[model samples]
Target: MAQWLDAKVTKRIDWNDHLFSLRFQCADFPDYTPGQFTKVGIEQDNGVVSRPYSLVSHPQDKELEIMAVPVEDGVLSPKLHELQENDDLKVMAPATGFLVLNEVPDSDNIWLIGTGTGIGPFLSILADSEIWLRYKNVILVYAARHQNDLAYGDFIQQCQSQYASQFSYVPIVSRDKADGMLHGRIPALLQSGQIIQQAAQPLDAEQSQVMLCGNPQMIEDAMDVLKSMGLKKHLRRSPGQISQERYW
Candidate 1:
């Protein structure tokens, strides 16, 4: 069982409509993989209830941060939505999960696919300096309901500027379309050959590796599409070229 620690909300950042970023202070928090999540227990009316949220900040940071979308019917999400500076919440520690770089084989091209707020961990992994040396081309494909729904726009642009030749950022907004951004769901893009066309190279299963994180349905859809393209599911015992983390 994980031990619960009481941490204060150091800051909160609103990331457009529906999503928010929360930074919490925890002393001596253990290092965690980017795609890992933590059970954040909320202070409720009668008792405390917790919900799992993916870690948004990179593990190297001292203060921990998480990006979340509020759910109305959720037991803990609403309270979390109302949180303010100095407010305290309990988090189950230390964080844990497998959708990280260590489980993946070192490769030349790495594809990080996500929908909605699921892109948090991938943001961390891609920003980390250690992973940059091993991977030649890093491609990020993010899909959201609207263009305004996209998060971390500035940070992504920074990556593009720094690693101009090595990094590629593709943002797909289904309901809201703009000139430069893809206008559809990620799976649809993959199936319609848009992603491949933009990639400018045949997405060969043998040479490419994929990391998926998002709503369960989206995760399932991505896995199926990739598998149909000959990509295999990765496992701890016998790893392959694809890995998934269902943010649900």
Candidate 2:
């Protein structure tokens, strides 16, 4: 069980009209691994309404961050979007999730694939220096409806600077196109061999470790294509080439 801890919104990162990130300060919050998520909530007339959000800030950051996109018919996200700096809220303490790198089997290449706000955990993972130490190549694949939906370009650039020879970023826009950016859905790109081509790295079950985070359908479809390439769902009991987390 997790205890509710008091936190206050300290800042906001607005990427576009629909997507944003909230950074909140939780002085007493325990340190959590990259790729973990915490439940954030607010008081409602009936009770406390909460939703799980993947941590976007690295473990070293003073404030915890979570990316969000408002769901027109949902309960928590819309209200969360309306919150301003200093607004008090509740965060379930001792953040928990299983997508962290410790759970991953080391390999020559580590592929981090995410879509929409699902990119949050990957952001956290990329911030940690451990990633650079564990893999020879780290490829990030972010797919969104438009170029605007892609967040944190500056941070990605920083990683590229530090690991110019070891890092690759593949940005895919489905509903829009931009020069020098790959445009398509992830599963299709993988199936057609465009993703690896753009990254200049092959997706081989024997040599690649793929971590997927996104909508269930995308994960589901992408896994099928990966399986065709000899990749299998990873499990501690029987480890394989692929691991996935469903953010939506």
Candidate 3:
């Protein structure tokens, strides 16, 4: 069983009214892969209220980071949003998840598809240098309802600067297009061929491997589209083109 360790909030980033990232420091925290998730908890009068969050921080980063949108009147999130610098919480460390790169097979192109805070793990994966060397091209397709809901602009810009040739960032906004961002949902784009046109890469089972994270509905609908396009769900028993993890 994973035991809890006390952690102190180093900082909190308010990406928008609802979305935020919390950075904390914990002593003796175990190392974790880029896409893995760990449990965060708040001690209460009855017991600890806990939830799982994928790490947005790099393995070597002194602070561990996780992003989330608070749930109104919920047990944990609203309280989490209220946390400030120096506030203490609990972490169930030694992160675990299947979204890491090692699970992915060799491919000509790697597509990272995410929606909402599902973009968190992809940020950590992009920060690591190994991903750059492993694939010919890395395409990040981030989907959000509106422009303001899309966070981490600075880091995304830094990545575009660092890996200009090998990396491609695509932002999709469904509800509004104030910044003129590509308007539509992921499943719709996958079906329309517009997304592939933007990435300038073909998504095929033989040459492409796509990793999806975020909304269950988006994942389900997108998987249906990919399957119809001949891509199979990836598994340890039988590796194939599509790999996915659902984010609450």
**What digit string (tens of lDDT, one per residue) describes model 2 on residues 138-242?**
999999999999999999899889899999999999998899798889999999999999999878987899999998899999999999999999999999989
Poorly placed runs, candidate 2 (over 4 Å): none
Instruction: Supply the global lDDT for candidate 3.
Output: 0.93
- For each candidate in turn, the TM-score is 0.94, 0.98, 0.98
Ranking by lDDT: 2, 3, 1
- Give model 2's TM-score versus the native structure: 0.98
What lDDT would each prediction earn against the true structure?
0.83, 0.93, 0.93
- With a 3 Å backbone cut-off (N, CA, C), the pairs that clash in candidate 2 are none
Clash count per candidate: 0, 0, 0
- Using TM-score as the measure, what is the rank order of every candidate, best first? 2, 3, 1
Tell me, what's the RMSD of every candidate? 1.6, 0.8, 0.9
TM-score of candidate 1 to 2 decimals? 0.94
